[model samples]
Target: MASSPSHLSSGSDLEKREKPLSELTLDKPAESPYLNDALEKRVWRKLDLYVLPVVSVFYLLSFIDRTNVANARVAGMQADLKMTNHDYSVALTVTYVPYIIAELPSNLLLKAVGPNWMLPTMLTLWGIVATLQGVVTSYSGLLACRFFLGLFEGGVFPGLVLYLSFFYPRQRLQWRISAFFSCASLSGAFSGLLAFGIINLDGVGGKRGWAWIFFLEGIFTVLFGVVSFWLLPKSPAHAYFFNENEKNYVIERLKDDGATGKDASVDAFSWREVRKAFMLPQTWILGVVLFCDGTVLYGLAYFAPSIIQGLGFTAARAQLMSVPPFAVAFVTATISAFISDHYHCRGLVLIFSSVMCVIGFGMFLGSQSHSVQYGSLFMSIPGTYIVAPTLSTWLANNAAPHTRRATAIAIGFILTNSGGILATWLLGALSPAPRYTKATIVLLVFSVLMVLFSALNLGYLWDQNKKKRVIREGMDRSKEDPSLGDKSAWFEYNL
Candidate 1:
């Protein structure tokens, strides 16, 4: 063999070279500053103390404003507006129309305007519209207000997801996302209790209980919006509590964990990237899986009380009955997120939870007994909720570059909401009462499909991991042996 370079021939120089290798290969590698538990705990506490509460409250308001209409309907909103059953469905569909259309652009604006300003502004605008809903005297007026509510509230969820990405790494993000999303479940249960209280206020100042629903909830939303602007942190780099050293440590540690810094430039959206996203086997696979999820999700939200009311409860009692499923969902979602993070495996959790949903839906479809059917509904709700945040966090983790991740998340939401649209028609008034057999069947079909798609996605990712390993090995070997020459190697994540 040829003699080593003169620098490496010296014993001291060789030791210096070997020291780094020894350190890297050691059983306990040197821990990064950001990885320090004390430091991470401090940051986590800051986020928990300051950020989570604000975001949770904001999303609570958003969820209340968006879905409380269902409660309003139960409290005689349909009668007040002379809205036929079909018209009520139309109003629900109208909100989603603008919601689906505005999602992508709104998230892009969230990136530009910063969550501190954008989220609160969006909330304020929707609050104004939601309050206006209380004043509507005609079916057309309710439609107008619903459309604008969708327009404003459209930005809330996805914007929050993108915003969370700025503050935490992918693994830690799951719990927060689940916690935030649990607000919807919280709102579902709380809305029932609140509607119970507000309905008792029906004759107060000549406003109906339904009007009080919009008025009080809208006011709370507006106030929370104002508070959010003041309380929310701008970004990790700009987090007011952390020192300069801490900020740099956070940014660098995230980089080591495969997350690019907030300041790093993401590739602009291009047809090429769009094609890549669309063609990636995971994209369509997740799309279908999420589509199924959306169907069950919105179906339960829109029709749960209706189903319960048909089971012999009065309207108010039916609303109360809707509470348990959502409560179960909230608790299960939080637990699932923590478990998924603990294991660092999302796909298995998703598959298992989705199967729970299938079983729940199957029970609902097959059973005629009220208690058994309702119990199934409860199981289905939590299982579906469990899959959602995990699926979202999984998608966010797999996407590279900030812009691409944003695009992928937005696309996933688009697909999911499209399923929501399908839900509107599937669970229409034409469906039989007490049973809603058509709706139940549709839910069962989609839940099974969701399981299948999730399985397919996991398989694809496993194969992609294998291919990536092979390519990386080849590249390393090529570096060591020049005879292999220079060849570029690249691979895509399954989805």
Candidate 2:
């Protein structure tokens, strides 16, 4: 039966038979194994397991080191050191000075050295300085340590954001960034609990309770840093767990969302890109939002225990009281980030979170009853924190080309640090004891401003999208060829 069909065919017959195979091959496209839904989910899970904890630990320590001064102040740091002049607030503000100045450059350096080496090393350095803060005798010494601590810790947040961007796509980033940031809230709660234990060690080795707070936290930071160097993945291209096909899929999927280039090459920053970042309206809007959010965040972080004490709680008890709000913040931020990611919506969630903050501040301003006021604190912490990570992740996702994204992130971070400075200065003169009415009012106003700005931003983005659609339809009407018009597509997502 085969002999009849297999006899040498004429060229015309051969061509006719070959045509169907050729058409079949072209018509039935090869299903991409790389884009397998199950595989992508698995990869994401692996990345989450590996990266989230290192980031959480790193930021937890960084946040603790940064804000433990608040705890220390309550633990008799000011009274023992004769810091009666309210220079502690000055010291706190000074920390952000170096932090703002150092942020971009430190992240650039992280690019050069690689995260595995640079991050852990920087963490260790700051940990040492944080510990040294405990040993400072003179006001000048504390100032010096604070300055250096800011300098070293400045790299951690932006560096971690950049690091995660290398591994995850834009939509996946918000929750991871939120998870990373929730460590800050967790640190607040943990620091309180940790301080509660350490304060009991008062007079150990002749050190005050505040000194033990720094000493123990700093040492823990150093230990975690050592662990991080080994555990942290450098980049997706170099990740040990994924195969080559998986790596390529990760890279290609990111390209679909406008990110390009493999993870091995570092994107260098350009002045042109820096200018583009500044020109983006979203950048300025985010700056304002961050400024407002920071006022609430830092005001509460820096002054919460003091405010609690003013409400008639003892110092240790105030520290304990501060824990519940931050604990609420930790849980709320995580839940917000997860829901934001699951829905693939960023702006709406951020606006809702900001509104929650406004409500919290309203309650805080109106109420004097201890339980009601404390309940309001819960709203403030979670609301402030929930917006921040989403805001940051939104900025990161909307910014394009690696270099521009990095610059935009740097600008956003600088704005955030500037907000921290503004927060400190705004609340600077508020009395340590009695009511913090002035600070409370400023925070409430800022929260309202954030809501207004967020609404304006949503409107602006909607208008831009409408304009883009009009432009696209006009082009389609005039086009000779659909393929050529597609190539000329100029629409971009508004941040």
Candidate 3:
């Protein structure tokens, strides 16, 4: 193991290349104290250009493939399949059953097989499934396709969150993750535009407009997946675009933030860490928060089209109307993320976002006026879209030892995705329309509950940070153990 002093020193090319995986260290003893602005800028530019775009594109397609069923419903899918209202809801629900079940195992596989291979491959499989959705003629076929689609799609979100932590430091992470996650909102807007165009091809091959939506989007996803397999780096040290110096800078930079536990040199998996993950209260706290957030987010994604249509527009117009709110959400979410990174506080933002949801959903429930209800959607998007990236970043910042973090992310996602199941059934059961009063009320309750939970979690982190500071003040430097890493007294939780 490299000691603190060893970390600050630079190694020769021979040392760098010859260093064994088990002996790899993230020390920066030889690094310059002054900033390498040009090199740093280039590194970020490459990441923004190469990494973020591919990841964002993958997620954009994922969201579209996952939620396009809602768009399909209004585009005449239900009538074509002769789906009862309950059958339509059942199709959505079936996807989540496999989705939630696969999350933990999929994240574990991400570590074992490597993200560059696992993520894109998963995308390709789901793309095939999504395209096949267009060919399904009956409710049973729809259910089967959805189940397999969910299984393939399950790994991407949590796996990506875990994969990203390997690259960015804690302070710099949320915005980048937010930037990637903003794709979901962008997808919402883009889905409408794409659907609008595809719907025009309604009789192009004797297929309905909704079928065309799935078929074309799925083809696009497959192409992107092939591109991603070539584009994505395996890890910081393995980045083909970076030289030795840049790779070292990347490693040292993240290690400085105590984020190197699962570096390229570390072992792939650890059962001990998996057990420890369950012991962290933050894991469950963040999971509960995600459950609340996921409900509103998926609820919006799965039903916004229906909601817009009920406001007195034709199906086509409703699809077009859905574009603006997500566009606004993209903007609002980006702004909120920048502020969150600037202040290094997720809790305040979490509460603010939840309040946005409460206000937006409340207005939707209370107001009979179409314009007011529609305006409420603009407020709701920022609220729902902001939570996942913010809260996921918060959990990523705190969870440690790569395995533990992966497990925590998997658990949180599994719980959160159950919210997807809830959203589908709730929408199906309440079957509210024109106002969707009952569903809106349920969303409001969850949103408010999230606010309370975020506040409590915030206080808990603050108190923990305070306690760690006290422990650090009294601890002897020589007696301190670097192996403890995030468990060390010097390791304070980022609020």
Candidate 4:
């Protein structure tokens, strides 16, 4: 039988290129059976059991802490602190400064510290800061706490994406990312319910309802952080639940999928990798795309409750109303991620979701009826949430070498947070809410641009894939250098 070329090389070092691919084979141990479909399924189930839930918990808290100020607004936070409109917007903007600045550095830190340690540490620090927001007497105090909160929380989402890429193949990554990101939507849903209950604590212990919201949520976050220290595994090699055979199987599966040494932590930071990540046009394309979506996402997350309040519901009723769109979003985003992964078509899925958002925003801009606006929210929320994981995984899957992928993910997230900053100022101050027609129009413009970017991204990936295909078919020997990683001739982009 003609031998299939070996794509499974180990380590991040340049030495992996020393051997020719035609001379290499699937190098499983003699004692181990080749991984069959059933065992692969079992492995995935086990991984999901350990990895997904803990990461989701961490992110859920992150989303809540970052956006809960929105909930607090209706609970009398702005009035109690005597914050002017400008003051509040500045507080929101400051958080993103540290948040964006810390993202890339945090990814590098995660590589050195290991995710199990680094993640819980960030969560704990942010939790303390988030909890302390309850005690703030002035707007400046709120800004300080939020800045620290952003500092701690910045790298987590991107860092987790890099960590997960180590375990799953590119074809399988979107659903996992979506499943993890669904927690953000779930956090949105839960924040509303939690705020509804917490706001009823008005005047208890002489503290306002909004203060209690921060204090309680922070305490829960701290407790969860403590638990994550034990539950979250660093890598396949470090997982306690997996025996030696299972560990080897997990590691081998990734290598077989064209990932080299992804199961190992990228301990040393590389400037070259950083440069490579920046050099890719797709990285900037996706970053700009994320920025556009980020405006919509953060704008909605930080203000959705307020937007609902504008629709004639009481603050409490508005909180309750905010829950459904996010709940629906969680469901739709999970389904979209699953379909994107199953079809290996992240770009198309991203485009579809972007277009949906544009349509929803168009309705929001034109319609006068509250009912139409509310329905438009259902359209907009799911589109915004679904686009996040799909686009993130798309960029991640196309990047090669673990460190380079980490850098790209980090840069992309920085853009995401930058958009969040712009969104805050635009929606909060510039638009003059109670009816943010101007902001809705701005967001609609962003969505229209996102659809164009997504299509362009898809076309670029298709063109690159075709070019690679031509090179691959023309080659007599499949002896490409493995060290080239994603740049290697055999690496195909998922379109």
Candidate 5:
């Protein structure tokens, strides 16, 4: 391997020429178990089965437990507690404050403790807090529960994104991310149907239907968390079900795609990489794009029941109506993700997704008909759902060195969930009952902003690739430094 010359562009690659290729993307595969194409397929199937499904259920339960509070509101808990729209919005806002504060620290802790410990612990704690929401007697009690739930749940989304990156290369990651993340859409449908049934249990065991919604759903999370503590493999290499050939394939492919540390794991934390992630242009730029998506996402999650019920339906009927849009979104997000992976494009897919948001949210503001506004949700649900996996994968794909990628993911999530804080207010406080024109208008404007920003991101990344191509053509860049990561001439940005 040729050493990086002092004149070979500026920055970290020049700063640490002596750093091992382990910190940079490996150009060649290391020695591995006797492996063939068929064996590789077999290994990936195991990963998809064991890893993907397990994590999906973790997120599904977590999301359901979190959002069922909305269902509870419609089922009569809000009135029972004497809460106003402002009080409900305040409780929801309380959740997101902790959520944003805890994002980076939680990812860093996930790195320190490993997913098996950090994820299951967080899941179990949040589950307990969610269950306790059922028994709260005052508005203050509800606020306290929401705060703890946010603190525990804050890490799950970013943690899952980082955890999956451990096993798959950049190109293949978005689909797997989609596969699990699609569960987020499913959770809404599931919450609706579950609330529909459980709310029927009102007056059973001296508990109202809304109370059962929390108790039953939270208990389910607790049981799942206990099982996950045992079921989840520590990492790809530690997956006991995989044969030696499968393990090596996972390790080698990841390292070839720029895994750090001995044995191609995520590696120990680096302050320099964390700082590098903070300084990247994409970190803040795309973070704003996510802010728009988060507003729509939580708007739907927190207010969908109320929004639907306001459309001249009974509360229980509204719960059932919310199901189909999410069902459609689950399928839409899955298909779009496959297309994203197959085409190796994130920016265009994001633009298309954002445009769907524009059309969907626009209908709410543009039309006076209830059915038309209701119909728009079909498009709106999938639009916002698609953004998270695609945008998060884009950052994860570009940032290199394990710590840098992980931090970039956390930062993106922070900016993403911060929008949820505004969502509680906009979709709840700013937009009142019976006719939420204000919320509809806000969603529409944000959708347009997202479309514009997605285009900007695509243009910027394309120009960056052009510059890197020039550097690659002019130098023996393979020898420069893997530490350059996505910044290196060797890496072609996925546009």
Candidate 6:
């Protein structure tokens, strides 16, 4: 087996790529003196500077385009299309069907083609579809747009998660993942502000105010997608912004961090790894958490304007009021993610977030005062948005090799968009406007479910870790089995 030094100091291609799967070394050497704490921090900071801003804008735009239907509804798309309440609900649900089915394959293709090409291409296609939503004269036309939009947007979020794993180690991923994911919260704020301004163009170009909303945002998205091709690099090894030494240092940090565990022998795509992801207990448990949390997350994002308007504000006032809760969530979500990373405990932070969500939803359910219900919106978003990034990071970190991690993330999001479908149908469409009693009750129930599932995941991971230790005490080092991946006696799951 080769040592760590041989791998880090090799030619431009990663040394791990050159080694046979069976002969790859598992231990990471101690850091060299030249790679000091200050220097390492500087490198990570520069990397963050390059990565976070670019991806964040893409995430922001994608979210705005997806959820802007709510804003359009407030400005009058439903009446213009002659759609009933249930029809609107059905429209919301339609998107997730293709969104769920396309994700796994999209991720696998990303592994083949790389993010540099795939992500931009998808964004541009989705953007064109979003822009066409403005021209759809009939309900069927709207459904077609929604379905195709879902197909294109499906891969982007999970693809972002898998792509980040290429550059960051498992333990260091939480905050960086959160940094980009926080853009979802920011999008809520931006969309509300944009809606407030765009709704004034009620008769522009012989189109309604809602049509302008779609037209303007979609145009911006198309332009951004084209620009992303130049901004996003294929991998750290091939990053254009980095000097040769910086590229070497970045890859080396990631390799060193893999020493403790979650190291699989095969770096190439494997069918075995993909199958193993389906069988892992954590994947389904996390999926349950995702379903519960996503019920609230997308509920708020897709229906916040409606919910707030239902709370007694005019449609215009509701558009402006939707801004603050999500703005606050953007800050709290980032702080909670860093706290989880600092403690190296994902499930506990997840449990805390779920508990906060329960309180938020409960307040909305029980209170008659609109003021108290509005205050409760603050709790809803921060609590729910925190789950997506943290839960994805936890699942991706525990699953090994590229293919398994990709598969697990895709499956988890299948459940998430499934929850989104339930949210729109249960909370928005079936329930009456203004008093959304069903909305509060449904959100409250899901919040409690999230808490229970998070606790179960915590206990399960702890028990599994204890079992691994017991096995480690009896195992022989010379007979170490790399094939076990995360199940190996020496591997420890970050709780």
Q: Can you list the residue pairs that collide in candidate 4?
A: none
* Alpha-carbon RMSD of each model: 7.1, 8.3, 4.4, 5.9, 7.4, 5.0
lDDT per residue as tens, model 1, 1-495: 123345444656535333322232112111222133334567777877778877887788888898888889888999988988788878888989999888888876666677888888998899989988888889999999999998888868878887887777767788898888888778888888888778988989988899999999998888877777788777777888776655655565555444442235433434454445555456678888888898888777777777788888999898888898888888888888888887776888888888998899888888788888889977898888888788888777666555666767778888887887777767766566778888888888888888888888888887776676687663542243211111112323422
lDDT tens digits, residue span 367-397, model 3: 8899999999998987899888898888888
* lDDT, residue 93, model 6: 88
- Which regions of candidate 4 are displaced past 4 Å? 1-35, 261-268, 474-478
Q: Clashes in each model (backbone N, CA, C under 3 Å)?
A: 1, 0, 9, 0, 1, 1
TM-score of each: 0.88, 0.87, 0.92, 0.92, 0.92, 0.91
Estimate candidate 5's alpha-carbon lDDT, on a 0 to 1 scale.
0.83
* For model 3, the run of ten residues with the poorest summed lDDT: 28-37
Model 6: which residue pairs collide? 310-434
Task: Choose 1 or 3, whichever is better by TM-score.
Answer: 3
Q: Which stretches of candidate 5 lie over 4 Å from their true place?
A: 1-35, 259-266
lDDT of each: 0.75, 0.75, 0.83, 0.83, 0.83, 0.83
Q: Encode model 4's per-residue lDDT on 241-340: one tens digit a residue.
A: 8766566667766766655443344324678878888898899888879999999999999989989999899989998999999999999999999889
lDDT of 2 by residue, 246-272 (tens): 665566555444444322232454566
lDDT of 6 by residue, 392-489 (tens): 89888877657777899998988888889889887666788777888778888888888898889889989998997798676674487555666666
lDDT of 6 at 436: 80
